[model samples]
Structures are given as C-alpha cells and as structure tokens.
Target chain A: MTEERDPHLARLFAEAPEPQADEAFVDAVRMGMARGRRMDLAGALAMSAAVGLTCVALAGPVAQAVGQVAGQVAPVMAELFDVPGGEILAVAFAGLMAVSAMVLSRVRV
Target chain B: MRPADSLRLSNAPEAQVIALAAAGSDEAFAELVRRRQGSLRALMRRLCGDAALADDLAQQAFLQAWRTLRQLRSPGAFGGWLRQVAVHVWLRHARLVRPPLDPIEDLDAEPAAESPDPAARLDLSAALAQLKPTQRLCIILNYVEGLSHAEVAASTGWPLGAVKSHIARGTARLRRLLSVEVLS
Candidate 1:
C-alpha cells in the first residue's frame, strides 16, 4: 500500500518537526572516520611488531632447520633444474623464495 | 582542503558529490553528509525516538556509507542507499536492547524518557518508539517518507508481505494507543 492509504499518517508526519542539518553532526562523522582509519593503522603496526618479535625469537632454530633441509634438497634441485652452480645456488634460490613469501604476506596484511 | 576543491564540492550536484566521494575526496563526502543529514537524521529520530541516539546512529550510517562508498554502483541512488545504511545501523543498535517498556498506551500524555526537547515531546516520536523495531521501520519508510510497500520492502530488505504486515500491525497498534493525538 502507498502512504495515501492513510492520510492521517501523512498529515502527522508533515506536521512533525524537521531534523536540522547541523554542521556539528557532519564534523562528528568526519572525525569518526579519521579516528577509525588511525585505529586501523595502529592495530596493523602492533600486529606487525608482534609478528616481528615472534620471528626474531624463532630465528635461531628456524635458520638451523632450514640449513639442514637445504643440505638434503639443494643438490637434488640443482640437478633437476640443470644449473651449473649446484647446491649453493639452489639453497640461495629457496631462501629468496621464502623471503619473498614473507614480504608478500606482510604486504597483504 | 584546498579552497578550489571545497568550492567544487559545495557547487557540485549530488551525483557528482557521490562520485567524488567514491573516488576518495573528503570534501565531497562531507558535502554529502551536509546535504543528506537533515532527512536521514529525521528518519532516524522517528525510528529511534531519542534525539542523541538518533544522531549517533545517523553518524554511524554516514561512516559506514563512506567506508563502502565504492560499492555504491549508482551515484543517483545515494539517497535510497544511504537510507538503507541508516536503517541497518538503527536496526543493529535496536537489536542490542529490548524495549525497556511497552510504550505507554497514552504515549503523548507523558514525557519521552531521553528526549526532553519540547518539539520531540509531540505525539509522533513517542508513538513510534512504542512500535516494535521492524514495525517502526516499515511505518517510517512507508508512511512518513511516502514509499510504496514495495519500495519500503526494497529499502528495508524485508519481504513485501512482511513490510505490509508491519505497516498494518503498526498502524493498528498506534490507533489502539491511548492519547495519541492522531486518534484521540
């Protein structure tokens, strides 16, 4: 049904006071939006820092584990890829890939 | 903001304002807020019955609109789109709390709990607060704003049947309310 279904409602609404277009309300919303953006940035920074600390704490063991894994796989990768610089080049490539993955994940965040 | 940008924002048509806002112009978005605030705020007040709460929800709606502005495909549809946003915000806030009391049958006979403004003390705002949230939603969109039932349904994302039902029930309930000046 349309509003004309009830003329009383239309008349009542028409007689009600109009809400004012207060500049204060606009400013409040703008401030709220800016504050929200700042909060998001602060939250992202805090999360990044927490992740960085965790990575630092685990760096020693993680490096050793990667080193052992590289010893096992580097030669095989080099042979498979048919590279002249065998094991060292394969290990370096793997390390570069891992660093790239980390950077991408951070960027996505 | 640059003086030229501010000038352009104020002088621009609504569709231009929406486009500029979508493209990340703060001044244009502020202009949108300024232009649209009156009606949106009024609708919120009718839905909520408390001036402060209505303003808060209205502000939240604008903030939400800004955040998702890029998703608004049609700039010309911003008024309806913003009403949808405002309705969503009000509904969310309303859902968080049950109505404290069944609105007094004679809603206009007494003062509104939070709204002390004499203009707001009038019958309509108090009567609206008494209606259930969905009922109130349908009434404001359909009756006050003069939307057809299908338009109210579209704006509220309610089924057309449900919108009609709420309007029917709300109107009857308000008619039953004592001391509402319209019926009294």
Candidate 2:
C-alpha cells in the first residue's frame, strides 16, 4: 500500500530550528578525543608490557613441559614409525605453538 | 598532510577531510566535526528529546569516529557514518536506562491541554517526544534529515518495510496531534 505524504508535517520538519554545537561543546569534544587517544596509547603499551612479561614468565615452564613431553614421545614415535629426529620435531612443534600463542594474544580480535 | 595543511583542508571536500583525518590529522577531523555537528546535533536532539544528552552523545560519536576513522570504507559516506555512530550511541544509552514499559505510553496518558492558540504553541520537539522511539527515529531521519527510506533502513539497520511502516504511522499520529487537516 502506498502511504500518503503530509505536506504540513514535512514543512514543519523542514522549518524546525537546527541545534548548534557551541564553541564549548566543540572544544570539549576535541579535548575528549585527545584524552581518549592518550588512554588508548597507554592501554596498548600496558597490554604489550603485560604480554611480554607473561611470555617471559611462562618461558621456563613451557620449555620444561615441552622437553618432558618430547622426551616421553620421541622414543615411542621412533620405535613405532622408525622416525629419525623425533625429538627435534617435537621441540620445533612446541616452539611453533608458543609463538602462535604469543601472536594470537596480541591480535585484537 | 602536515599540521599547516589542516587549515587548507577545512575548506576542502569532505572526502579529502576524511582521508586526512584517517591519516591521523586531528585538524582534519575537527573540520569534519565542525561541518557536520550542527545537523548531527539537531538529529540527536530530536531523537533523544534532550539537548544536553544529545550533545554528549554527539561528542562520543565523534570520538568513536576518530578512533575508527580508518575503518570507514568510503570517505564520501562520512556524514552518514557519523550519523550512524550517533544513533548507535543513543541506542546504547537508551538500552541501558530504558524503562520497562514504552515511555510513549506514559506520555500519551498525560497530553497537555490544548493551547488557546494551538498552532502558535505547537512544537516540533514536543510532537516528536510523543512518538515511539523507532517511529520518531524513522520520521526524523526520513523527513528532517532528508534521507530516503532505503537510506534510513540502511542507517538504522531496520528493514525497509519497517521503516516505511514507521514513517506512515508516525506521520499520521503527528498530523492528528497537531490537528492538521487532511486536504483531499
């Protein structure tokens, strides 16, 4: 169904006074943006610091765990599949996972 | 663009201003804000029914735009993008503080007594305050801001049919409230 147009309402809306943003409002917004930018910078720096510290803190434990797991699995894999360099492969896989975790943590989404 | 170039961008086209603003030029962003604030503020006031809140929301919207300016795919659509931000800000605020029942129903029960000179006392803001939120949004965006129905739908993320229905019903209600006579 076609809707009827109202000339009176349209005229009133057209003639309605537009609200102005005074100097104070503009300055306030500008200042707010500045503060927001500062906060954003501070937040990103804090996050980066936190992530770096976390990786540093976890490095020893992660290395130990990866060593133990690799030690346990390498012989089994070598015996089962006759694979060479199983221990090196496990260490490389663990390093890849740790690097992936660090990268993923920094990603915003 | 350098700091000195901002003064030049003030008079430049919106696309240029948006591009510079996205490139981290505060002055360019300020220019865009100065250019669009009036209409955005007006739209917010009509939508929110409070000047102070409208200004607050508009400012927040501008800040948000500044942060995400690079995400703006089309520089030419800056005005619409800014408006959509303002509307979303208002909607978020509205959602947080909205009452259980529709506020318009409460307003409807307490209609002001007709003025001795009805036409003289009629106000666009007052009439708008009487409308349901979605209806008022559609009405202001369509009639006041001069957006097409599809544009309104795209901006509000509402369906095109819903936008049309709201405009139709909202206009009819407004005419009745203002005692506008139908001219066949």
Task: Note the residue pairs that clash in candidate 1.
Answer: none
For model 2, what is the C-alpha lDDT against the true structure? 0.76
Itemize residue pairs with steric clashes in candidate 2: none
lDDT of 2 by residue, B1-184 (tens): 5766756776698888888889998888888888888988888889888988888888988888888899999997777788888877877777677753232343344344445455644467887888778788888888887788888888878777777877877786677667654212
User: What does candidate 1's lDDT look like per residue over B35-150, in tens digits?
Assistant: 99999999988888888988989899999999999999898788888888988888678757854322222233333333334344336677777777778888888877778988
lDDT of 1 at B39: 93
RMSD of 2: 6.8
Model 1 lDDT per residue over A68-109, tens place: 656766676768567565567767778776775555445544
User: Per-residue error at B104 for model 1, in Å?
Assistant: 22
